[model samples]
Target: MATFQIEGGHQLKGEIRPQGAKNEALQILCAVLMTDEKVYIDNIPNIRDVNKLIEILSNLGVKIQKLGQGSFSFKSDALYLDYLESEKFKEEGSSLRGSIMIVGALLGRFGKGYIPRPGGDKIGRRRLDTHFGGFIKLGAKFRYNKEERFYGVEAPNGLKGVDMLLEEASVTGTANILMAAVLAKGKTSIYNAACEPYIQQLCKMLNSMGAKIKGIGSNLLHIEGVEKLSGCKHTVLPDMIEIGSWIGLAAMTKSELTIKDVSWKDLGIIPETFRKLGITVEKVGDDIHIPEHKSGYEVTSFIDGSIMNISDAPWPGFTPDLLSIILVVATQARGSVLIHQKMFESRLFFVDKLIDMGAKIILCDPHRATVIGHDFESQLKATTMSSPDIRAGISLLIAALSAKGVSTIHNIEQIDRGYEDIDGRLRAIGAKITRFD
Candidate 1:
């Protein structure tokens, strides 16, 4: 197995370009199937999950040509509907959860869709009910093969757009439903939809492809169904999760790092969120400069002096994906904060590893963690550990970078699935992390 041998206590100083958005790439790549014409996509992150999805699309007969680095031209004119029912497709689909979007596209174009039980991070029960439930609400016949663990959706009469109020503001669910509704028979209004940057990007791209979608940043989206969608060129935004990771890494290790070309206007409330933790983030043109902390980096309490609390919610709130990074950053801060991860149930379990590194944290429950900071007085003692999920894996890597002594993190494939060239990028910034067996 591959592992990362990180030598901590070294300060990183340099500018690093954040990768293209991985989450958006997943949705966009799947959206390429919405058209039979040549669809050109630039700024695609060449990571494991996206590569796997590309592999799946190739097996289904999509003609994909590498236009250049981080760019691809896809033509779905030769798409094979029968390939989705094959055993090989099932094996590939089970590797990543984002593969489920393929089903929505297939159902839209061919009146049928098939997928195996999708696989992703083991953070919690990421139920697919929201996705399939929306499909059923759209007049599709749904069936689950319990013995073979397969899901099938068929709209033999063709899909008719209907108003859907999703149970939760699920990101992928909203994307899947929106993709399906783009070519439906009528208008589809989605209430409580996920308005994440990725979702908004997907909507804009869809509209460029001839789909009429309203309400760009709001929770309610109105999609006017079209007979067919055409090809369009789309460039993905910078990875917000990666931007947040760099912010936490800069603070945790007391380094000065500049995240380049982050598309400042799109990063809603992310910069201010870090400033609340006493990290000095300066905006130079369009880049984010995080300078090294020279004094006490304390958590700013609420106006009434209550212990600061950071929690995850839908869009416009702190993302749940970066809560682990926040937890690690808080370990070296000057004050306490309660991290409430309300979205995922088991994401906060990684705090045990942080406590073992000498950070003070309390596992209030599966959803909440109270972290008491030491203001860099107590250093983290590094040891070997395994990465649980993609976000948590990077968070641990950041913690290991700041800990004293040599730390080894196994199962780094989880980290590589999302981050593009992470070790190489860190090395450019003077981070002492190497991938080894």
Candidate 2:
């Protein structure tokens, strides 16, 4: 129940490195379960969800060693199969949605995977149909109990790969199915699969571990089952969502900041998407630089002079995870933009908090918000608020950093589930933010 008390109006200027990707870390940690040898992973983000996943792995008897800060070596040779059915596992694993990936990894290794209905933010209905459906398509028996709300998949006769098309390009679903298919009996072709950098990185990591997977950055992936996979070292890319957040924060608060080691090649349409919101994001080698804005940036209108619409879609489209930050930054821009958060229904509701802070915004619906820029003419006034989820939480923090007076935010535990040491990092760059009991 810790809270953040932020003294607004500080001009941040310094270099800050984004943490390892949280989304990728989740899949990579689960991928370790596919091999029995020691898997060494570097640049792992020290965050809550990752720690919880590691705890679950430790409880399952996966030998884990902390090599150093943000580095770990994992060996699954000593896994206790019986622990999958333990009440302790169900209680802990269900706390985060990433734990669902463990099921697919277990199915790939031992022909069985079980988990209670997984837990995560109440942003919307994040269905598991895609995951279980993918498993069933690959010769696994999928069962769900209505009373207990448990999901279980088993392939006692061993899994045989089958061509499958996902209902949607669900990222976690793609990872789960890809993991399951890697050790199955035949070639598996997945069309309309998610090709986000996280998923592509998983393919590369799996291939390094001796799994045969083609299509590194495309919607179609082909996996040829191998007898087994071996361990390998993996270094995670920087957190793109965090990089986007820092961009928004720099623009909103008139700060100059440099985000280091972003792996720009993997950031598809992210930097350009921020530039569309009137922020100046420059590519300096592998880093992203945002210069302080004396004259606030203005949103660019379409060629037809109509109101700009920023909507999210699958890979190559603007990321839904960043729509919240864009909406917050648009509040201070010189022009208006309609933020269409198509992926998650309840994400735009956080605009109410911004409106309270003296921003002009309209919650058009659950899925869309229209923000009219104040351009610092009407500066935001600080207020008390609670963080809803990871993206929205960071958005609120960005708003607070740009407001007048002080702002106190609660439920930062939701923020910590994603970002790594956000307050400490902000403090290093001259943000007056502190954590308290």
Candidate 1 per-residue lDDT over residues 236-259, each given as its tens digit: 999989999999999999999999
- For candidate 2, the TM-score is 0.99
List per-candidate RMSD values in Å: 0.9, 0.8
Backbone clashes in model 2, listed as residue pairs: none
Supply the TM-score for candidate 1: 0.99
TM-score of each candidate structure, all chains considered together: 0.99, 0.99
What residue runs in model 1 are displaced by over 4 Å at the alpha carbon?
Answer: none
Number of clashes in every candidate structure? Answer: 0, 0
Error of 1 at 214 (Å): 1.0
Candidate 1, residue 101: the lDDT equals 93
